[model samples]
Target: MQYIYAMMFALEEINNSSTLLPGVKLGHHIHDSCSLPAWALQAALSLVGGDMPSCNSAAKYEEEKGIGASKGDQPVPLIIGGCNSVTAQIVSRLLVPLSLPLVSYTASTPSLSDKQQFPNFFRTMASDVYQARAIAQLAIKFKWTWVGAVVANNDYGLMALKVFQEGIQRAGVCLAFVETLQRENIVSDARRAALAIQASTAKVILIVAWYTDVMELFLQLDKLNVTDRQFLASEAWSTSSDLRQSTFSHKVASGVLGVAIRSSTLPGFDTYIHNLNPLLRPNDHFLKEFWEKEFGCSPGIATASPFASLPPCNGTESLWAVNNLFTDTSQLRVTYNVYLAVYAAAHALHSLLFCPDVNSSPGHNITCSFTNQIKPIELMEQLSKVNVTTPQGEAFNFQGADITGKYDLVNWQSSPEGQVQLVLIGLVNGFDLHLNESAIQWSTGSSQVPVSICSEACPSGTRMATRKGEPICCFDCIPCADGEISNTTGSTQCVHCPSEFWSNAERTACIPRQLDFLSFNETLGITLTAVAVSGVTVTIAVFVVFLYYRQTPMVRANNSELSFLLLLSIKLCFLCSLVFIGRPSAWSCRFQQAAFGISFVLCVSCLQVKTIVVLAAFRSARPGAEALMRWFGPGQQRGSVCFFTSIQVSHYFDNLSFTPDSVHIQWLSEVYTYYISY
Candidate 1:
């Protein structure tokens, strides 16, 4: 309906402008195709003057006006109709023999690009080849690897399906299912397609069908309460009012992803649509039906024609108060195509008459001549070279067999009041696509695009491996092997670490594997140092107590010299542990090991000497043990401690003699450095 109103507006604008087509009035015989090829074929035959008698009468009238005629009169100068590709193909075949110029607004099938087949046919929209690849690219951008497809069983659907199948497969996306919906028995076909869509595992579904067929599927999906799935729509129904105007369908179509021909504001189009007077269109049956449906009122003398249930018209209804699909200017992608198509036809006629300068053609130049002798075939040649500026100052041309145009990607998002709107989220020009993901909304009302993957993504430290006989979306995650690293999620394979580095515990990253040694700042090192210092403090306190009670009987009986030697050895043991606390240098390594061994041996030897002296004194009470008890004196006990300590000292020098380089000697072979140094 918007397209029809747009065409009417464009023609009116051209006729009212005195600068363009001076002394020439352009008129048209419009017909509704009803989206059927048969109806379109009938209209095409009528455009060539409806048979021989009508043609002869027209030719006779032209002869009476003193004009030469050739091959009888050629119908109207041009035709603009057949919005769909299927209908346009049928209508173009009939109009080709008569050499009628047919300019279509939205017929975008690639099969029509052949000049031999559709030479007289041209369109204002881009071909379907671009649209199919754009759809596949959009799915890949969102990582929607698995999807379901539903196409109408027609030429347009089949051709688009083939192109899209190749495109998606090239992008590595797998189809979960492909269903078809036919125009005849649309109700049953939509139900079956809906069942297939529901049974499939894909969360995204693509529909390549007309608006009417899509409406039927929407009805079936509504019955099943399937509102959470995502949709990828074709240009055929992506911006249709039939789906956008209904509250129920809009709810189900919320967050619908699709492509549409680019559209812009047309300044006065909204006012023109709202101010349309139905009373002035008394001869238009379609306008009457629109009035009846929009206002719930019927024309006068209405009988039982299924429209009788509507309230009778009082002849006073205002179109301004009826807000309906015709008034919406928010999505005018198709309407803009119609507007440009009309201007293209008008510009071709202006060129044929050779008008100079549309802005100043009244008095600046002589008016071009026009006669009935000029044929429609000559007008088609002019249309092929038509180049004119649109009302918005944009270029409109049909120089080539097909026009390349831009497509806008829109998402249906819900408002706070539950109304849905088409939000522009991205665009495609030629083969390049630019998407702003932040502007999109999902059916679940989430700002994030819902995940449509068949499996969870593999985490870092693991690589994805294909599962046998399954789709690409289904895969396995395997952990990286030793000496390898997988730093990214969903990595295909692991990377090997360098020789000087080693993998981290999780194997997600690598770090330098230099010789590890303990430092005083670390927790383990600090703990060990505190314990050794505490042991030294206790030993010093015990030595001071014994020195204070040197003359006491108990102190004397325990041999004061041996006790002093034992306390000194214990102090040396604690002090020697500090040599291993710092980094292993030449002096620290050699002294740490030698001092620790000698100090521990001295402590044990002094204890052994004290035990033997105590037993000898007890045995001296017997008469024969007096000499043996004398030999085990304090000097003898000291000699025994010295002899044992000397053996340890000798062993330390023995290891140093063999190695010769103190720095090369590892303190605990550098492996236990972390344990012993701390």
Candidate 2:
């Protein structure tokens, strides 16, 4: 299934950013969303001399937290989330008088964005009303005259259902019974629960319960065979793997109705996926080669997105500005969107403070770098209306109380081969955005080559290649188990595949860490030592092969691109076999096994490439001899690399640049100074 992964990205851009007035090394403090009370947050916004916190206090509070400088001199700006409406409502009230900003990624409650009451609230997603309208239209399309509402007892539920009711009425749908479900009753008797819901005369049941409850209700209905009514849902059901798995799920929802803004249909989504990692050059030469080899496709593999405007985190993008370290996150965009939302706050603070119209009273502390005071309305009024491209691509300009944006609809389709494929089913361009890519060949729901991540699962040691679920749809890479590390995503192997399993050439998998001694000690340690020793000896053997059979089919084949790759694979397998000699973990573990699989695949791939190359080369040689080649095979054939070690060593040892620090620093300096990187 297309995983709708969510998490947070923490950005620390404020640490290095400066205001119009200089000299203040920006100090920051953060609180777990888990326990941030209203009073504490209120205390956070009060500014008084010597009452606010200081950087010097960081060392003092290294282990313990520093209370607001008893006087609360510094006003702390906050960047919170709309994971739920209660917190958003609370933060909205707490922030209004403080002139502090509360930017929300999903606070679509409409009231928060009112500007009159909560003048400091900012939102990026469509409001519940907008979603309600979309759902209403979908309901009308199904000609659902009588629709039932099974809503949760939460703020999101209440408000969302209200809006949905209004929209449905506006769209000419009859008012079905509105059943409010309670959180406490989720585990209650299913028969009683079904009876309660059965009272709704509407044939279609649309539940606005919290995500967890919606799925649970389906299960309860399944257990009770409560399949008389048709099931309708929302984005909550879009990516749930279990929803479609229940026994009565399909029967209850065989023609279920729902509303969702298919992600792929959104403008810039495909491009964002193609260039997911903002850190990588969209058109890099070498990376393209490695990327294609690792994941079969090269789009959407960047470290951060241009849409995600946050501080770069040590070669990666930390989505939020927590007081200290921030983790990679993807909210709507796999939770990391939270970081993008936070980073937007930092950018706003920076922009407003630096705006020429911005004014700061004299006598402000040199330590207090003033964040320009602008009401949310004023800030929204002044900020550029043009769409700002962020790495996350989720943060968008406020659509003026109405969220109007394109959405993509796709479903995971399984082929006869049992391969799960994400197929684009429809595209709705509500806001009319012209995309820059060719992936979305159909706009109004047509089967085209839509953007997809081919389930090219990056192994365990390798975490997600992009933040858990950046638009790319592929798995990420992390360092493999048992130590060793790589600096990029979707690595070919884990470091140190252990003793029992021999590490493959790519290190993606490991073979049994056994020495082919033919006659030796049977102990594991001795076998491992033999394995490591064998690895060294094997490298020597490959070198010898180059020296002697340097011209044999096995060696001469290295001349052609495919043959060379095959040879490299064979040699790598041999070298990896030696890994058993160095180390081994327990048996049957995926780490070692994965390494072996990768190694074997690459080796065989080498052979395949060689076969194709040989066929091409021979066909070209036939030339126009009686024009047979013209009729069958004849052309100026061009072939590329084989990565054959013996031949590649010259390119690697002599020309491949290894000066990383200099290269990176120079690159960064160039981007800042000249607006470009060479």
RMSD of every prediction = 15.1, 34.4
Query: Which has the greatest lDDT?
Result: 1
- What TM-score, over all chains together, does every model reach? 0.65, 0.42
TM-score of 1: 0.65
Off by over 4 Å in 2: 1-30, 34-76, 170-172, 188-193, 196-203, 227-229, 241-257, 261-336, 355-387, 391-395, 399-406, 410-424, 428-678
Identify the runs in model 1 with alpha carbons over 4 angstroms from their true place: 50-75, 165-171, 244-252, 278-316, 355-370, 432-436, 497-505, 509-678
Report the error of model 1 at residue 384, Å.
2.0
Task: Report the C-alpha displacement of residue 516, candidate 1, in angstroms.
Answer: 15
Residue-level lDDT tens digits of model 1 in 165-283: 88888766888888899888899999998888777778888899988899999999888877778899998888776697786687676788888889777878888988766567545
What lDDT does each candidate get? Answer: 0.75, 0.46
Clash totals, every prediction: 0, 77
Model 2 lDDT tens row, 574-660: 555444343333331223333433455555445544455566656665645535433422122222222332343343334225343
Per-residue lDDT of 162 in model 1? 86
